[model samples]
Target: MFVLSSPSGTGKTTIARRLLAEDADIALSVSVTTRPMRPGEVEGRDYFFTDRAKFEAMVEAGEFLEWAEVFGNLYGTPKSYIKAGLKEGRDFLFDVDWQGTQQLHQRMETDVVRVFLLPPSIAELDRRLRGRGTDSAEVIAGRMARAQAEISHWDSYDYVAINDDMEQCFTRVKTILAAERLRRARQTGLVDFTRELMR
Candidate 1:
């Protein structure tokens, strides 16, 4: 599991999109959310939309690998979907928050590569949030408050990248992914190949 986490408006989504487009080996893990689907978001592509009741039921059934309530909506990773993908030797990219990252790391420590993105400055973050023009002043205030809280947990991540420039930040993120992919434990056929060579 490769996770990219950041406060809202820090461009984590943009970096994630670029990484997904460029890396065929890594696939985005579509999470299930109780939040209403926004405009331009596809049902299964963006998220598996559900009601609070159904989301609670899924939690009760132990269907989620990790779940959390964020901004009054419940979001979770479906355990089975990720497990099946892992079994097929596929990597999953997770766009999650600090809480979700913590849970994933606790459960799958060796498999999880956690990366956190930081905004260059609070002023820039505010500008980017307002630039979106999707939220009201009150909503943006709430997000700003939450952003500070989220950035406090920056030390928890395996890698931290300050997104001063989108392209540069994306390059750093891709580099982390490339290096993590080459970790010794993740190299599947190494032992067998070495044994055959010795024989």
Candidate 2:
């Protein structure tokens, strides 16, 4: 489980997009959400959109690996989907908030690799949010408030990246992934490979 978390305006989402586009080895874990889909977001690609009631039903059925209510919307990672992918030796990139990442790490600490992304500064975060020209002032205020709260959880992550420049930030993230992939326990066939080499 590779988690990338940041405040809304930080380059986390954009960096995540670039990772998915460039790295064939890493696949995005499409989460299920009750939030209304954005303008260009696809039904299944961006999120598996559903209603509150249905989402609640999924929760009741214990379908999620981690779930959280964010700004009145619900988001969850389906447990079965991710487990199957892991069994097949696949890597999944999770673009989730701090809360969801915490829940996942608590449940499977050994499997989780948490990365926290930060903006250059609060002022820059605010500016980037405004640059979108999408949200109203009131909405932006709420977002900025939420961003501060999210930043407070930054220390909880295993790796922290300050996203001042997009490409540089992505390179650092990719390096982290490469290092994690070589970890002894994460390399599933390493034991056999080592034993064969010794023989």
Which candidate leads the pack in lDDT? 1
TM-score of each: 0.88, 0.88
Error of 1 at 20 (Å): 0.9
**For residues 9-121, could you state the per-residue lDDT of candidate 1 as single tens digits?**
89998899999999999999989999999999999899999999999999999999899987799999999989899889899999888889998898888899999999999
Clashes of each: 0, 0
RMSD of each: 2.4, 2.5
Question: Model 1 reaches what TM-score against the true structure?
Answer: 0.88
Quote the RMSD, in angstroms, for model 2: 2.5
Task: State each model's CA lDDT, in order.
Answer: 0.92, 0.91
- Encode model 2's per-residue lDDT on 1-199: one tens digit a residue: 8999998888887888899999888899989999999999998788999999999999999899899887799999988888999999999999888888988998878999999999998789989778768879998888788899999999999999999888899999999999999999999898899999999
Alpha-carbon RMSD, candidate 1: 2.4
Q: Which residue runs of candidate 1 sit more than 4 Å off their true CA positions?
A: 35-43, 132-140
